[model samples]
Target chain A: MLSKDFVGGLITILLGSLYLFFAFKQRVSALADTVGPAGMPKFLGILMLSLGVILCVQSVVHSLKTNAPALVEWQGEGKRFFRAFGLLCLAIVYLVLVSILGYVLAITVLLTLVALYLGAQFSGQLATIAIGGAAILWAIFVLLLDVPMPSGILL
Target chain B: MDTILTLLPDSLNFYLVLPAILGVAWGIIGGSLPGISPSITMALLLPFTYALEPSMAIVLLASTYVGAEYGGSIPAILIRTPGTNAAAASVLDGYEMNLQGKAGLALGISLYSGVIGSFVGLFFLVMLSQLLAELALAFTPPAYFALGILGLSVIVSLSDQSLVKGLIAAVLGLMIATIGTDPVSGISRFTFGVSGLLPGIQPILIMVGLFAMSELFKQASILEDLRVKTSPRIRFPEKKLRKRLILPQSIGALFGGFEGVMPGAGGTIASFMSYNEARRWSKSKDEFGKGSPEGIAAPETANNTVAGTSLIPLLSFGIPGSNSTAILLGGFLVHGLIPGPMLFARSGDVVTDLYAGLFFAAIALFFIGYAIMPVCIWLVNKPRPYLNAFILALIMSGIYSINNSLFDLSIMLVAGVIGYFMRVMKFPFLPTVLGLVLGFMIESNFRRSLLLSGDDLSIFMDDKISLMLLTFAVIFVFGSLAKRLIQVLRAGT
Candidate 1:
């Protein structure tokens, strides 16, 4: 059985140290009082560093203790994780493409891909959901709410 | 009182009623689904309220919470699964009652209890918030700063399992809040040369991404085939049974009101505690988990009661007491309105409208829950893949609709990933959000107070209100740690 806390704690510790360095290096005005622009960041950095260290210790202790609750990672869960991660990657690419491809086109394409990922095919149901859903949202957001969406190239 | 007379008529208008009912309808659908929460529902629907009047928007979000609290019991009774966390206790007797061929009875009791609890909770909301607001009217900048610190200190209590993880999350949120231009210095802090960062990151983006997107990502792992019967489920309680429900309902209202006012003890805890108390005092205690009416009534009533009363802290001190109210805080800020004692003094009319609308939502829950139970059950039992896809599309489109920035979309996706990691590690999400909400309050006020004085730290100690608030914050953090330590030591022994 493997637990997530130790790795999470290590990440937090690294992030905390980075923030602590950034906080200490910032220069502010002489008129600054006991705390200034750097004050909050420094305080938070120290807090995170200390907490992360303690969490790392706790995770180690719990993992070693015989009486501690078992924390198991299921086999084949990696496939599920990657499946969701793949959707996230698709999202990031679609976001970048929105600047050039326009929201309607990008969204239609993205939604089609998402529907497919969720098991829908490039059939009528997928077309109606992907295209219709995008059109309806564009109308609601742009026409009704007056939100200025990117028209973009090839719209 | 006069404001209520004026605002009561406005709450019934199409603008207010439509969103309120619609939010309720959406809330029920969301609540009846196992993974969807009241906060997530509110977060998803928040962007849609951009076109709504501010008063109407508040009503819409608040009413959604009210409806979701009751909607959670539907799945609890029909299936063994509790839709919302607050409904977990209801499953003990609710599902048992269902197995005994009394599903409608359990649902009817749940609805009745929710309405009664809501009315009682609303009374607490009006009385407590007004009283607290009156007290807060005398607070200066230093006091407000201390108050914000006190709110942040709740992370200690909210992180019941591990305070260390909670602090890390809060610190992360505070650091994120420090992005954009420094308020006091009039200089850009961490914009990384983006013009959109000038106004700082939108909390709504973070909220939708954290709650909605993370849930969508999490849904990829869960594969369940939910089933719902088309049988009509409209059973009203007999007069004799209604008499038996009163004691547990009263107990639930008491526990709910008490917990709602507390920062970290939310509706889930309140319902569970109320169930214990209800069973302890009931005549038929042996039937507690074996299809007793009191078991269903106690938790359902208690959780729903938290809906209105949880807003007391938000409305009075500009500090959200729960995650759902945190989203409501976002709703307030989106409209360029800040809530506090000033809100009561300035926008008394809007506050009145919200109260009237809450009153309307309580009554509306009964009619709406009865009318739409079958539809919600059908929707709940629908295939997960299509449902997840639709929700994901709704969230992404909704996020893009607000400000229409590619950068904002990226921020949301990043937030969703961070939120997912936080969830995986069992860290509390509430503190991170409160930190974000209260970060500006704590920083701006702390510096402003010192600048107003001649670099005098004693000014904070001099002001009675500010000193009291800081003292309370210190005690809260230290006291919670000490209590948790004692419990741990006792367990080890």
Candidate 2:
């Protein structure tokens, strides 16, 4: 398995490079001022690049010492990686549905899905908690607090 | 003093009192849980403050910060889980005291010590803040800029384990901070013409994601059920032990105050340092780790003491010395109040109200913590999965409530993912938030100072205060490096 640092370092390196590429492409002032709009980003980009390189070196040494291969380590952590990835995907889908289904209905569904994913029993308690919790939150936010909630066709 | 007294009564309307209770109560529950910190609890609740009157909102957040300090000690004494980072040192003796069947006495000591710490901390806070505010009145733009850099320099001491990774996180934050329109040139840098990007990332959004959502995501994988249950009781100390506590509590108060005033030295450091100092001054030195009242009292007092006094920097100079104060800064800004010396002149009444509110919070913490410690003990026995899910739902709802924008939700989700991964990779999250908070200030001031000087780099050097502040930054960064190099060199031999 690859050490965690190696993956982090690699991602940081790519991100730093991306920032620098865009920063250099940016249009600053017509007077070509120093420390202008591009200056902070550019400075940050270079700083990240150097730091990423150091992180990469340190992680590589750590990986060598620990005998962990880069690609295999990511593939090895199946349950953890998948749970996190699944949760993110679930959030995205729920968010997309929020405007259409309204927050209350959508959040109830989101809670149910989350409960199931977390391996909670499919009991009436689950239903009550999900629905009741959603309603209470809705009331607190939309009614009392006067925050406008997105309502869809069905609602 | 008279002004504060007069304002205090008016500030305690039901609108304020009710939220203060809720905030303190909720803060206790959140802080007693294993994974949640005081700042995270405050972050999760930050969005709700938008609907509140500024005074009520500020009081709610401030009081939560207060209540969480005592709450963090519950699990420390019970399960040996350092509920908050600052409570880590308390665990050694707290859990030991629990084992010795003095759980009630230990609980009492923590409560007493915490209240006493808050009392002393309040004294320091009220006295020092005015003086700091007076001093801040003299600062120019250059000095403010230098102060921002000085705040960032804290990452050196904060990230003792990995400076490189810390720098990377901070730089990323600074980069993200540059996403909105440039404050100086009135030109957009990285917004990509998106409407939401135009106003820049809201600190509230970043705070919510960085602290709450990210923590939720991290807990998703490692969630465990707590089967341990103990019905604990509380008993106030005897006269002798109470006398014993005075030495440690005083030590805690003194050390905690000194640490709180210095940027980067936060409650965790203060707690541990006070624990050691208390031991050094104690007659029963060997009892340090073995159910010593001084052990629990000292650290608990110290960490709680930090809750009030850490605001010295934040209230005085608008420079957040730690993560909690940084969140407090967000609360201040949300209410159209900028923290600094001008706050006294522009909003003296509000400042006085805050002092009054803090006093109330300190008192509220004692009663609330006293009532809830046993409830927390019972709650800890409940299913962890269920608790975690409920908390996650709270986080999502809170994020959505802000502006009701899908874009803000997306930012939160992305930030959560970023934060979760940052944790998985052992990266420090606080520095990133700090960098984001201070990045704009640092850049704008740097640019503005340069622009005024017609691009002369010597302007920063010529300004005495800026020079001294920057010099400290340079020294801290290099001094840390030198210390590390010497260690590496010595190890090689």
Candidate 3:
């Protein structure tokens, strides 16, 4: 039920407070000595805190002035939400695998997984998919131009 | 004359013959493929140009730019999907004509208008680039810093709906840029004691993730079957459509050229602005969304025209007119050619070749874009979803291959997530990229200028150029605020 503006303002205020804490620490130094390291940060901190306060105030004002749109309740039935989340997971997995399995192998597996998740019709043919995907990847990175992918033992 | 004559032999072989052909070919391929943009092609080609002669390298890059703009129309006319973001405006009427079995005619008109618009845009590029080249010689560090900041300010208008989010993203980008080591004092700001962060994130990989990977993530939701079965019906338009299209095309061309002249405004803005004007001024305003040919012609003409005009600021002053032009800056450095005031004095022949190449590229794109578009439609409209997956893999691999570093890949991933979030929030992603790209330049210049002035703030106001840049930045920010206020008032009423 929380408004995006409210959430955004809360985060800004939290970040601004952190900045202010840092700014205060820098304030103990002499003004001339402080100018180089802390001048911009201190100025930025005050500005950020002021902006955060303004945002918080604006969100409250907007809510009071107009009827807020009802937040859309998350429906548990959506495949899309899971699929997007899965993509982030896959990317992270791919990143970890890249060094061990080699870049080319890791990329191939990631692409196949993504394509399958997208419910691609071409997934019916397993070998064809791998060959086709690998060919395109090789052409772009290896043949057409020399991009140094981790060949490792796979080459 | 003697120097010109001596350089002529190498220029003829490398600049004229080789680069022009390569540029047109790349344009046709880039344009024909849906989602593969000219800017991407330019960025990809940038590394290869590093080993080539500066004059030839520049010519190739410039020609590719010109060709890609015109080439985007091929897919837009023959199929419903635009080949590039710039061609999105053309899809309304173009696909309508295609459905009506007039694909050939739509393509012909698109090619004709693109050629005409590009010529007009090039005239401005030539005239303005030369003038700015002279003015650029006087540029001070403060002026450059102001120019960079002003460039980022223009992003407020890029997505007017989420100006706050855009500014946040831009500021975030600047903050991120402050990582590694301070330019003035070599103190680490936010590198977390990592040596990799010392060099900072590379621009190419960031761009790849921001535009390409983020788009892939978003497209994951579209039904894969929807991409597989649509038959692209293309037909050439007849006399009636031509008559309606001509007036709007000419009208759009004028504004399009003007939009191109301004930094940060590119085809998307030009097309949107022209489309609105065309609707407001048209005799048959009711037929706009209903596949009016004028709708297609107006935006299409302006979009391509903006491409040629975008080069003006880039070549003349080293200020990028758009994101793609910013990417092309990599090419500038890679080829050992700097693109500021000294560019003209150092490499006049290269600049002239670029100018001439753009003109020729416009003509080549017209011929190639028209003739090969139908085939391109057939190729791009393949109903295979795995093909897209394959291409996506290739693109990602290409990005990885560039630096061969896992660090850059991680940066790309982070940027993609940020870009995706920014998109959902209606935050303009381009400005963030612009800010990240220009942040170091702005910061370094600001420091240098301050050092030069001995902490005198009057140095910024005293210089004519610096004052002009600061004034432009002020006007852009204020004007955006005023526009938002007006919109808010209208909504209230």
Question: How many angstroms is the interface RMSD of candidate 1?
Answer: 2.0
Please give the ranking of all candidate structures by TM-score, highest first, separated by commas.
1, 2, 3
Per residue, candidate 1 scores C-alpha lDDT tens digits across B334-429 of 887788767887787778778877877888888898898988887886667667776776787788777766777889999998887777777778
Tens digits of per-residue lDDT, candidate 3, B110-199, equal 776777777778777777777777775688888887777777777666655556555655655565665566666665555556888886
The prediction achieving the highest lDDT against the true structure is 1
Task: Estimate how well candidate 2 is docked, as a DockQ score.
Answer: 0.61
lDDT of 2 by residue, B1-493 (tens): 5554565675565666666677778778877888889999898788888888887888788778877887888888888887799999889899999998887788889988988888778778888888767755566678768878887887886676788888888887888899988888878888887988988998888877877877777666676775445777778789988998999999999988999887778899999999999999999999999999999999989988998889887888777777788888899888889787678778777777677777777777778877887678776776665566666677777777778888888998888888888877888877887798888888888888888898887888888878988998899778877877898799889
Docking class of 3: acceptable
TM-score of each: 0.94, 0.93, 0.84
Cα deviation at B318, candidate 1, in Å, is: 2.0
- Superposed Cα deviation of residue B341, candidate 1 (Å): 2.9
Q: Which candidate leads the pack in DockQ?
A: 2
* Docking outcome class, model 2: medium
For all candidates in order, the CA lDDT equals: 0.83, 0.82, 0.68
In model 2, the runs with Cα more than 4 Å from the true position are A29-33, A61-76, B1-19, B482-493
Clashes of 3: 8
Q: Better model by lDDT, 1 or 2?
A: 1
Q: Which pairs clash inside model 2?
A: A2-A69
Interface RMSD list for the candidates: 2.0, 1.7, 4.1
